[model samples]
Target: MATTQTFICFEQAASRTDRRKNRRGYLVALLASVLLLSACEVRLHANLEIEEDESGTIAVVMAFDDALASMAGPELGDGLGEMSAQLPSEWQAEPFAEDGFNGIRITVPFESLTELQDALTALTQGESGSDLPVGELMGFLGDIIPTREGDTFRFSLTMPAGMDQALGEELGPMPIEASMLDSVFDIRMSLTLPGEIVSHNADIKVGDTLVWNLSFADSVRTLQAESMLTSAISGALIWVALALAVLVALVVVLLVRNRRMRPMAHSEQVPEEG
Candidate 1:
């Protein structure tokens, strides 16, 4: 009976040891699985939009709309977040949108008003041949014209006499120049991510709504582009230099001509002969 009881005790101890070993193996496997999962790589998506306001100012707006929000907000945010992170030199963000129209508003100022006007003028040159209505011209050049406290200039657009339906519909309201973008403006982007249940990367898996506003201030204070100021100075200097050179040449020519044209006075000779 003693030997049998001893044998039973040894068997129980062996079973306990085996169970402990099995438990340790399971724990190691669980930890290894967790490490592998943590090492998993993730990929993000890309979607964007671009727009502009009046006043010949440009605005680039990028957003996912609603279709992309179905994926994951973190991924969308990460993808757009990279735009800020990567192109740090190109643009920056301010306190942007919280939801709905999510994105940034990038405003490019009109440093050279003349240049902007000229560009708009050129864009609408085609309209000169078309028989567009009178009101449309105001809409087209509204942004191009400059306004201040006292100064105001009104312009009328004259189109070719004949008119047609096709031309009217194709060309909507001439692009308006919005004064809102005079000093600074905004570009907005909206991104939406869909929600998911029981995701491993829960933070990145849920639907997210991100909207940011970006500003482009005229930091240089002056335009770097070829402007009327440079052109005017260059032209004035060239003409002035030409005028001076021409005047000097004219004076020299007149002096030489006078010397050649002057008749020599005959020397008064007292005749020594008498």
Candidate 2:
């Protein structure tokens, strides 16, 4: 009986040791996962909406994964605040949270395409005293200035093929690996025009909106879209001209009929006198 009780005690101790080992293993894995996620996960979206009068707004939203946001803690909020403070007076910014993402949304309104280009240039080139990940990625997008030819509007953007090398040359050595840049970051852009879509090299097109998911590649990547604006005034003028022509034709017909009837009535009355 004494030997059997001793064996049972040893088995119980072994089981307790196994439980502790399993818990430690789980803790280690959880920490590693958090670190990996926090190291590389970001999403950036930029949208440009142009009105019929060529005036419009540009909205840029930059968000991070929930794990990354939680890990960054107050530092992320502080960085966004600093960025907002540095923006121009016309630019507006507010905190954004959606679909488990935490970030900021910036809006800039422009009166013309030229002004829009200027705003985009400032956004990509302006100096902000924060190390926000979105800033460097925005620099990768080349200048996007839309042109107007009569009733047609067009714009094209070429994504640099050698993005990592260019970034290294312009902004010094990058901390993220070249191969991992695409996987770690997601960049998307959409342009909403005030006309019917004529042609576009976008990944998705919904009516007048063209969306492109940007990525780094070995060859030149070009995104071009053209739209033709329909003029309401021209349509109205055509209808007015048609109505006036119909009125003139009706007046001529009535005058001819009246002249013929008067002659007939005169002949009839003169015959009775004869």
Candidate 3:
């Protein structure tokens, strides 16, 4: 009877201890995900190769600062790993690391842009039709922008709202200092375009490759400003407006000439009465 009671008491204590640790982990993750910000240096380089048939391959390679992977704990890394694992098996062949950076290189094949879009949406959001946690955690990553021109592809990443943007007055004190987090993290991007790329607006352009020279901190600031700038009318629209203005001016000059000529004709038709 004594042995059985002792065993049960020990088991109960162990279970309680496990529960406490699990609670701690939950609190830590919740606070971090909700209050604290992700590291600033989250770099993703996606290489796209599209055929004339709209079928192609896409390789999304991502890397981050070691300090970030270490500090953010397994939540950050595991989230990333989960993202890569969720991809189709055939395309998950690339090694997850290169040089000194911690990363995952996912190479996927697509039958069409629509198919690719579905895969991308899944990556950002996750597979649907289940109660499981598919992609809720990734919502905090950032705004991922992808622009495609033929076989050329570009992605612009911005940190999450509360994490990087200029905060509004309503949001009370920030959970973490920007400067402190900024010092420990950084992000950059690059792309390997297909075919002979003769035109590009990237900071770093080498043959067919494009790269952004800005740091993640600088990148977010610049991108926000860029967003504001691009909201205006495009250059082509401005040119169209100018063309309309010129046409209107020419019409006004023609009308003035016709009116002046009409006066002369009316005077001459008065049979020189003066």
Candidate 4:
């Protein structure tokens, strides 16, 4: 009888311990869900714009830092070699290999508003319907701009709000018109994306447009590069949270079982002493 009673006590204690462990794990899981729900997620936004002349020639105007212009042509003859450097290999097989893109160009790199203004003035004066550098002459004729030394450029484009959102995602092949705005050249654009449509925004030209079939593909590569770091950080946070939850549940189970055993052990000792 003593042996049977001892065995029954052990089984009951084990069952209670198991139930407590289950409860701890359930609570831990609930806490984990709450933590995850409370965590803030950073949104990744991409913006891209394309400017094309009336002749079906396209120039991709990127709003990124001016450092990228290093990959642009020196003066339209440095070949596709320079641009291919800044882009994915797929670009080589398309725009780089096409003839229309051969005519596409880069603008002077801009470091500040003053520099940008200088380049614009230079372009405007040079293309003065008379004497100007071939590069500036091209701008006067509403052709592509060269990638001059600079950080940013101002092109005239009448853009709508929808285009702004789409530009954030870098979605492509939108229509752009290069027209004259009195003395200024206006690069008017109209884009319709998955959700909305943007009608107008004056674009400031900075670098040369990447012409050719591969322009779109090159853009995707750039967009992917910009977003990769953010995505990785988000994924890591998710895993870390799950691991911490598991560790907390283990600690809770151990503490609960220890508390239950201590009381039973004290009671048994008292009986022996009596």
Candidate 5:
């Protein structure tokens, strides 16, 4: 499919439109999250929804405290603009920001797996776009990646390496004090893939969809293990694979049977005795 380039964007300081987040009413039953971090208090949430045609919507919401935000000021003061420039102009949508948190909303009218390949590469490298490190984009957004099997597609999101250190270097590491280990740094991610869910490692699973309610501490550990955040398989796809395997086997059997039967079936009758 032909694809026009696009990127994430937020509005100017003058226009802070309050676009309510997509409540996910249609997807509530389909999505759930299984991972959760015990102590971290910071939170970042990315919600992605895609259609069978590859067209979909992706939204990323990140929250940080003033102290930490100020520490990374030089690298990310521009905020949404940092992430917006990375996306193609076609997919640009206004971003929203509040006192301590920021949000980017984008509508992907149409897309192809090829485009997702770039997104995946960019995420792994921790770069939202050219020249901008994920550090500048707040790091949480780069964790998401896309995978495909047959006609079905799977996208998984997890914390990227160095992010913990980056934040630690800025905001400082989680204090040893037991009181500080809960929801201090949190990141929530959600998305629906193109197939029936085969299996997943998330904290919650509602149908084939995934909603991740996780804390920074949990995500950091999960990232270290590189555990699967979410996975899905189209129910129809399972049958398709089985059907193809069966068809191929049948073809081979038929060919072998024809070879074995040909000589005997065509053998001339021995009339000499008669």
Candidate 6:
């Protein structure tokens, strides 16, 4: 009887362990599904506009398709509200609904390039004290850091490696096939600088804006753009040119005055001699 009781207790424990494992597996699968859905059903657009002083505004819009909105239900609104609440007090977040899509728009204004870089880094790394899963998922996209060299501003984005491996390690295998990612997952980014765009490897150029369309089809992607800003040296040279023009004009006026006086003096001398 004692042996039988021990066996029964062991079986119960084993059953409980199995149940726990099943629950864990379900949660993991759910998380993976959410991520996959976000990738496929969400569209992200980010634009950065910088002034001559390096002060800029970053506008980011994340829109969800009908499928994602339906799947998320009311939880979508709650999640967006939570994300807004978690952002820094200075950042602006607002609800956005347009062209059959609904989502949120966040506008971040920075007084310097450093602040802009920090904001981008925080969003990509999910270090902004937000529990939003999108932030974490954005970590795999890549990095955007703008640098200034005299009159030129350089921007480069390089996609990181090991994204699939990282996802696999965390969530086992990807629920969605890799081939579908290209069709469903796309992100558009645009940058506008204060001055002329000198050179860029962007997919599209519209006036002063350089646009890049990114997708998950490639393991690695690189984007680069260089723009020339109005430098102090250029301003100083302009001022110098104006000053030289003024000086030349004054010299010409003096020469004319001297010539007129010489002719008058000659006529006066002739009258005195007569």
- Candidate 3 structure quality by residue, lDDT tens digits, 1-274: 3322332233245553443333322322333333224433444455555444556776665665564555555555555555555564444534466555576666668787667666656554443301112223232222445455534444445543433332323222445455443343333344443344434556776655565543312423322111112213355569899999999999999999999999999988887556
Off by over 4 Å in 5: 1-43, 63-91, 95-110, 117-143, 157-164, 168-184, 219-274
What are the per-residue Cα lDDT tens digits for candidate 1 across 1-274? Answer: 3322332233245553443333322322332233233332111111121112113342233332332333334554544464444332223333234344344333233444454454334322323311111112212232323321112212122222111211233222223122222111222223222221111211131233333222122221110111122344567789999999999999999999888666543333444565
lDDT of 2 at 119: 71
- Candidate lDDT values, in order: 0.31, 0.67, 0.46, 0.29, 0.45, 0.66
> Which candidate would rank higher by TM-score, 4 or 5?
5
Clashes of each: 24, 0, 2, 36, 30, 0
RMSD to the hidden true structure, all candidates: 28.7, 15.4, 12.4, 33.7, 14.7, 11.1
- Runs of candidate 6 with Cα error greater than 4 angstroms are 1-40, 140-142, 162-175, 230-274
Q: What ordering of candidates by lDDT runs from best to worst?
A: 2, 6, 3, 5, 1, 4
TM-score for each prediction? 0.22, 0.65, 0.43, 0.22, 0.45, 0.65
Candidate 5 Cα lDDT to native: 0.45
Off by over 4 Å in 3: 1-44, 51-53, 64-85, 88-94, 128-186, 194-198, 213-274
User: What would the per-residue lDDT of candidate 6 be over residues 126-180, giving only the tens digit for each residue?
Assistant: 3452233444444433377788887888888786432353344544455555545
Better candidate by TM-score, 2 or 5:
2
lDDT digits (tens) for residues 87-128 of candidate 2: 656668999898888888988899999888777766665544
Better of 4 and 5 by lDDT: 5
Between candidates 1 and 2, the TM-score winner: 2
Order the candidates by TM-score, highest first.
2, 6, 5, 3, 4, 1
Q: How well does candidate 4 score on lDDT at residue 236?
A: 73
Off by over 4 Å in 1: 1-227, 261-274
